[model samples]
Structures are given as C-alpha cells and as structure tokens.
Target: MTTMRQLKKRAQFLKAARGRKIVRRGFVLQAVAHNEDCDLGPALGYTVTKRVGNAPQRNRIKRRLRALSKEFAEKFDPNFNYVLIGRQEALHEPFNELKKNLARALEKIHVERSAASHAIDRKSKS
Candidate 1:
C-alpha cells in the first residue's frame, strides 16, 4: 500500500492554499496538482492557527487530521497535494463524522477539478 507523504515546507503549504478549497465543519481542505512530474505519492500538510486555541488544542487537531489522512490514504490522488486547516470545531466533532467529511471532501475535489478542466477545454476550443 502506498502511503501519503508529509509536506514540510512553508512554500508547499502556501502553494496548496492557492489551490481549490473545500470547507467542512471540522477543517478546510486545500488541494492542488503537482507542478512537476514525479513518482512520489500524494503529499499532505496540517495547520492549526493560534486563533483556534492553545498549543495543546492545536496539536490535538493535527493528530486527528493525521489519523483521518491515514485512513483515507488509498483514496488520495497521487498527483495532487493536500493540506488540512483545522478549525475549532474539530475538537468536539465526532471521529466518525470527521472521517465522513474527509471522504466527501476528497471526492468533491476531484469532481471540481474535472469540471474545471472541462471548462478550460471548452474555452480553448472556442
């Protein structure tokens, strides 16, 4: 089984921020396709701002996100990078619900990407 790689650079996170965003009750997901051709698996990053809570709370949120990512590792598109921005609600949200949201978010991102590509194709053909 292929495992997701962790995104460790500030630039990487910033790049993802400029990509597609999907907001959920527990967190916001940002995704973008890889800019260069490489064989590495999908990359993931986690961020929880100070505005969310203290360090402990933020750490907790990140831990939850990591777990969710592992569970959905197989569903991740290897050609894309993803970042999860944790919200305060994540602390109280049920684990099962978070998992469901992550799954839906991943599915939605692909649908949106395809639609966007279709739009670009239509424009170029015109």
Candidate 2:
C-alpha cells in the first residue's frame, strides 16, 4: 500500500548514500538513502533492475516490495528517502519471507540510523 506520494524519485536515489545489508539466505538488500528534504514525513523509493528479470518479473518484485514498505512504514523514520533494490532471487521468494526479509532489512537500517543520530545529537549538545 505504499503510495506514490511517499516515494523518492530517480534523482534523489542517485544522490543518496547507499549500503548493503545481508539478509537471511545470504540475500543482499541494497539501499540508497537521503535525509527527508522537508519536514512533511519520511518518503521511500524502490527499484528492480531488469537484471533481476524481465518486465513482468520486475513489476512483480516491485509490487512485493511496495506492499512490504507500506506494511512497515510505521517503523521507519519519516526524515529520509530510501530506495530498495531487489535481486533476482526475490522473485522466487514467498510473499511471507519477502515481507520478513524486507522488515529485517528496514529494522537494521532504522536502528543504525537512529543510533547514529542520537550520538550526533549528544555530541552537539555537549
């Protein structure tokens, strides 16, 4: 249920810093992130390369990721733009597992980013 309004665009994706987090089964989840440009809220983006599959396959994976994003948006900080890149194996994964993987990846990102922000705030407060 992730809406288009919550999504970041291609330019933003290219401008973001990125990292990879390994998930269960050694699947690598890639993310490119930028701070939320405005105070409105957190926004997210997704990309499925044709290398992952053909047109239909890419769309299917995009759909799965979108659903997962919507389902877990509450867990994310609304001050950053995030783009998720899907792999070919993602196509074969069951919906539940896909959801779980997405959740795990997002959780790791959230915790890491939150800790980093907290430390920065503490430093600035000193």
Candidate 3:
C-alpha cells in the first residue's frame, strides 16, 4: 500500500530518460532506479506536449495519463522513477486497451532491469 510521489523537477524527468523505456500505442513509459534510499514509493511524472494536440486535447491526455499512473502504480518498482509521455492517439484510445498496453510495458521494464542486474552479477563473479 505504498503511495507514489509526484516527479515535479526538470532534472528528475531528465534522469528517468536514461533508464529503460517501453513504447506503447498510447504512450511511452520510462523507468530509472532511484539512487537515493528513501521510504517513499516510485516517483511518477506525466507529459503531454503541444506536439500531441491543442491545450484542451493535451489536458485530456494528461488527465488520462494521471489515471493510468494511479491504476498501475503498484506495478512499478518502489525504487524506480517513472515518466509517462502521452501520444496523440491517447486522446482517442480506449481506456481498457491503454491499461493493457501499460501493463505490458511495465512487465517489459521489470524483466529488462532484472536481466541487466543479473548480468552484472555474473560479470562480477567471473
């Protein structure tokens, strides 16, 4: 039952860009393991730029992304920071499909991260 912190700083978003990324039909998800040790859950950020649409459309996309984050918050690792970048299709995409894609994205990110860490461990042991 961990609550997520909002990622508000510019640097926080930039840092997350260096981590694993999953692109979906409606959005792109980026996750980076946090360096600082803290009790708070994963930090989350949402972005829907002018490239997607006008102010109203962008707002709609952001709203959907906010809901998506809340629904999938538990799916993310507690030590990671995540950013969801909304696409133009997000405005018209079905909610259920969006959720499905997000779930898949989360699974891929988790798998990739674990594999990377395992590789590092193997390298150190060699």
Candidate 4:
C-alpha cells in the first residue's frame, strides 16, 4: 500500500486551487503539476469548510477523503499536487459510491489535461 505525501502548507492548497477543478457530488478535487518536486510522488490535502458542518462533521468528511486517497494513491500523477474539498454530501454518501466518484474524477482530470496540451501543441505548430 502506497502512502501519499500530505500537503501541510496553506500555500500548497491555494496553489492547487488555481489549477484544474473537478466537482463531484461528494467533493471537489483540485490538481496542479508541481514541477519543483516531481519525484516525491503525488501529495494530497483535505479541507472541509465550516459551511459544510460543525467540527465533528467536518472531521468525518476529512476521514472519508483520506481513505479514498489511500485507495487510489497509485492512480494519482506523481508530478501533481491535489486538494480535496469535502462537501456535506460526503458524510451521508456510501463508501463504495464515493470510491467510484473519485476514480471517475481522476480519470477526467488527466483526460482534460492531455486535451489541453494537445491544443497547445497544435497552436505552436501553426
């Protein structure tokens, strides 16, 4: 089982927020390439706003996100930093469903990234 590197700084989370964002029912996933440290593997950060719930409820959302991160660690791109913003729905959602959503979200992020790069390549060639 691979353990993901944890993002500890506020700056790290904020930087990811400026990158690609994928919104799902359970949570929001933000990902950005960290060119400075690609060899460290993917780093993960979790945040739950007060609007979602009180202290205990927010903590539960973070816990569920941690589990999902662990299960999909290898699927994450090593060069990217990711932040997961927990939503209120996360607390009531089934674990299996959350897992499926996460998988789909990751796939979508990479696909979009590749498509964007292809567009850039075409522009440079013209």
Candidate 5:
C-alpha cells in the first residue's frame, strides 16, 4: 500500500512542484504538491516518464517503486505529494538496492516524518 497516494493525471503531476527536494545520493526523487483539484486529502501520486524505457522496462521500475514504498511507508509523510522519476538504471537495479536508494533519496530530500502518514498506512493495512 502507498502512504502517499498515487497521483492521478499528467496535469496533477505537473502541478505538484512546490519545491523539488532531493533525498538520496543516487536517485533524484521529486516531490510536487498537487492543486486542490487533486482530492488526495490523504493520498499521494506518482509519475514515471517514457524516457525511462519501453513498456516492460517502465513497468518494472513502477512495480519496484510500489513494493519499495509500501515496505517503508511509515517513513514517508502521507500528506505530501511525490512523483518518482525513473533513471536509466532504475529498471535494472536490484530490489534491496532500490529500497536503499529510495531511503537515501528521502533522506537527501529532507522529507520530514509525519506521524499521521504512518498511522494512515498502519490503519490501511489493518
């Protein structure tokens, strides 16, 4: 499950950039807040571009992100918006390495911890 809900459309992802914060050392994860049009209230959104690769490659990255995020959802602030942009190697990275990369990305971005996000994730799981 996602702590920050998946962002909906292309326009929504476009509206999300209040400040682009970097978290990890290797990856560049951008956090963009959506407009009110985004009723995410408690969820966040995601966007992966074609630049990443063909359908299969892109899908692999997205799947990895979903699994990685859910495993560490408690660390992310749920109310904030985030869009994961896959780098060229994103598809080929090992799962644990990707999780570490994501954690580092969050750390680099200085994404603050939100108790509510953890609570939300826990609640959702239960």
Candidate 6:
C-alpha cells in the first residue's frame, strides 16, 4: 500500500478544489492527479466549514471523514491530492455506507479522468 500524507497547507487544498470532483451523500471529494515530477503518494485534506456546524460539531464531522478516508485510502489514486469536504449528513450516515460512497467516488473520478485524457490526446493528434 502507498503511504498517505496529510495536506497541511491551505494552498494545497485550494489547488485540489480546481480538479475533478464528485458529490457523495456524506461529503464532496475533489482530486487532482499529480505529474511525474511529484513522487509522493496520495495527500489528503479534511475540512468542515463553519456553515456546516459549530466548532465541536465541525470537529466531529471532520473526525468521521478522516476515519472514512483512511478506511478507503487504497481506493484513492496514489498520485492525486484529495480534499474531502464534510457534510451535515456525515454525522448520521452509516459508516459502511460512507465507505461505499468513497469507493464509488474514486471509481467515477478515474473514469472521468481517463475520458478527459483521451479527449486531449485526440485533440493534439488532429
């Protein structure tokens, strides 16, 4: 399994927000796959904004998201930086369901990425 790193800088999370994203029941997942120049494994950031809840509530939401993200760490692309935005429902959602959602989101991200790459290649060939 590839090593996992925490995304500490605000800029790193902001960068990932510009990438492909998938909305799941418990969270919004955004990912940007890195180029060959980056050799590190997947880096993750978890955030629950003030709009979501108070400090304690937001902290709880972030904790759940962290656990779910860790459980499905291998599902994430090794070369990508990911940000998981916690949702209110995340507090009450079943743990297993959250895991499934994460897996599904990862699969969708890969599909969309591959399609985009293929289109870019075709455009360059023309």
The candidate that achieves the highest lDDT relative to the unseen native structure:
4
Q: TM-score for all predictions?
A: 0.94, 0.72, 0.95, 0.96, 0.66, 0.91
Best-to-worst order by TM-score is 4, 3, 1, 6, 2, 5
Candidate 1 residue-wise lDDT, 8-115, digit = tens: 999999999999999999999999889654477899999999999999999999999999899998889999999999999999999999999999999999999999
Question: What local distance difference test score does each model get?
Answer: 0.94, 0.65, 0.90, 0.94, 0.62, 0.88
- Name the TM-score of candidate 2: 0.72
lDDT of 5 by residue, 60-121 (tens): 77777777677767666544577666666766767778888877777655434445457789
Q: How close is candidate 6 to the true structure, as a TM-score?
A: 0.91
Clash tally, candidates in order: 0, 2, 0, 0, 15, 0
State the lDDT at 15 in candidate 3: 95
Candidate 3, residue 44: lDDT:
91
Rate residue 36 of model 5 by lDDT. 45
Q: Report the C-alpha lDDT of model 6 over 35-120, residue by residue, as the tens digit.
A: 63345678889999889888999999999998888788677787889999999999889999998899999999999989999999
Q: What's the candidate order when arranged by decreasing lDDT?
A: 4, 1, 3, 6, 2, 5
lDDT digits (tens) for residues 26-90 of candidate 3? 99999998986658878899998888889999999999999988898778788899999999999
lDDT of 3 at 39: 80
Error of 1 at 116 (Å): 1.0
C-alpha displacement of 72 in model 5, angstroms? 1.6
* lDDT for each residue of candidate 2 in 1-126, tens digit (9 for 90 to 100): 323344546576665435434454413544445454545656666777767778999888788777767787676555556666767777788878877876787788778877988999999999
What residue pairs clash in candidate 1, if any at all? none
